[model samples]
Target: MATLQIDADNFQPTITNNATVIVDFWAPWCAPCRGFAPTFEAAAEKNPGIVFAKVNTEEQQEIATAFNIRSIPTLMIFRDQIVIYSEAGALVPAAFDQLIEQAMALDMDQVRLEIAGQQASS
Candidate 1:
């Protein structure tokens, strides 16, 4: 469950297959990103079922633009092929654990029904 280095090429396939995917939007020069890297890696090891991936904003500008990442060290969580949570800044381990727990607690059936309702309304 090592964190996967993701770019535009691998992003779609990698995320779609996993039930839960946590993506870290980072850049090498950013101090907070560096600080968060270990936490991210440790979480990946701890949660073997989830896909933990990193997109380097510095090297993968297209991916960053597609996701509209305005800040360094943005974190996104995807579940059941949809983005469930996204936020900017570094997460302390406790917060990260809470995020994982939230993701785990999600009822994807309800989420998808809500998405369908939204799409129909739109």
Candidate 2:
């Protein structure tokens, strides 16, 4: 599967509907963003079950602002409608793949429980 170009219009719905989503926040002018594109694409192709989406920060400023993206090439992973991972910077292919594997291996039930516990404490 190829990466989907996501905009403000579809971003929420896409994240809400997909079981696993990997979002790349980038801009065309960023050198590192351009460099990381291929690795993101290759991962998308390799993991068809995961929804790989890209948000052009230059064009979708609203979406970028909503996420408080302060850097280009910010990567976020959403699983079960929760943000499981978010980071700013380009990762090597091995690290990226390892992240995907770790995300997939997460016990969502435990994650939710932890979230609920935190919320309750708050």
Candidate 3:
């Protein structure tokens, strides 16, 4: 269960299906990013239900800019086509697990409702 590789051209489609997708923004030259790759892969293997993906920042500058990625090894979890959790820097396995749990706990429907309510109030 290797994480899907995302690029500037296909990032939207990768995250648009309302599925839980974890996108790892990384660069080859970053030592921390390289060190976390195996951990990310193992997590992907453990969680087959989630869509784990990688975005090579060096190769996808536009995508990086769109996501405001300012650091290497940034992880962004998207649920229901919306960003649920995002963080910069490489994470240890335990931290990564916590991140996944947090992503899973997000209530997208309620978030949407809140946004709608805010709009109506405005």
Candidate 4:
């Protein structure tokens, strides 16, 4: 599976439809973002079931701002339309793989319940 180039137009729909979506917020000029591209692409090929998408922050400033992305190579994982993981920095292949595994292993029902509980308390 090739990494999908995502923009503001498709971002919402993609996340809404995909069960597991990993987004890499990057800019072409950022060295870290460039360095992380191959790793992200490889992971996309390895995990055919997951949607690996890239958002170019330089072009899609609105999306980057919406997510509060302060740096390049920000990684975000969305599972069942909920953001399960988000961090700024490039990850090694091993760590990235581990994260995917953990995201896949999560019990979404429990996650939703926790969200509901938190919302209720709030």
How accurate locally, in lDDT, is each candidate?
A: 0.93, 0.96, 0.88, 0.96
Clashing pairs in 2: none
Per-candidate TM vs. native? Answer: 0.97, 0.98, 0.90, 0.98
Off by over 4 Å in 2: none
Residue range with the least summed lDDT across 10 consecutive positions in model 1: 13-22
Provide the global lDDT of candidate 2 against the true structure. Answer: 0.96
Single out the weakest 10-residue window by summed lDDT for candidate 3: 9-18
Give the residue spans of candidate 4 off by over 4 A.
none
> Candidate 2 lDDT, tens digit per residue, 64-108?
999999998999999999999999999999999999999999999
lDDT ranking of the models: 2, 4, 1, 3
Better of 2 and 3 by TM-score: 2
lDDT (Cα, tens digit) per residue for candidate 1, span 1-108: 889999888999988888889999999999999999999999999999999999999999999999899998999999987999989999999889888998999999
Tens digits of lDDT, candidate 3, 1-122:
78888886678888887489899999999999999999999899999999999999999999999989998889988888877678898888998998888778877889889878989999
Task: Give candidate 4's root-mean-square deviation (CA, Å).
Answer: 0.5
Could you tally the backbone clashes for each prediction? 0, 0, 0, 0
Q: What's the distance in Å from true for residue 109, model 3? A: 1.4
Model 4 residue 87 CA deviation (Å) reads 0.4
Q: Tell me how far the alpha carbon of residue 35 in candidate 2 is from the true structure, in angstroms, after superposition.
A: 0.4
Q: Give the number of colliding residue pairs in candidate 1.
A: 0
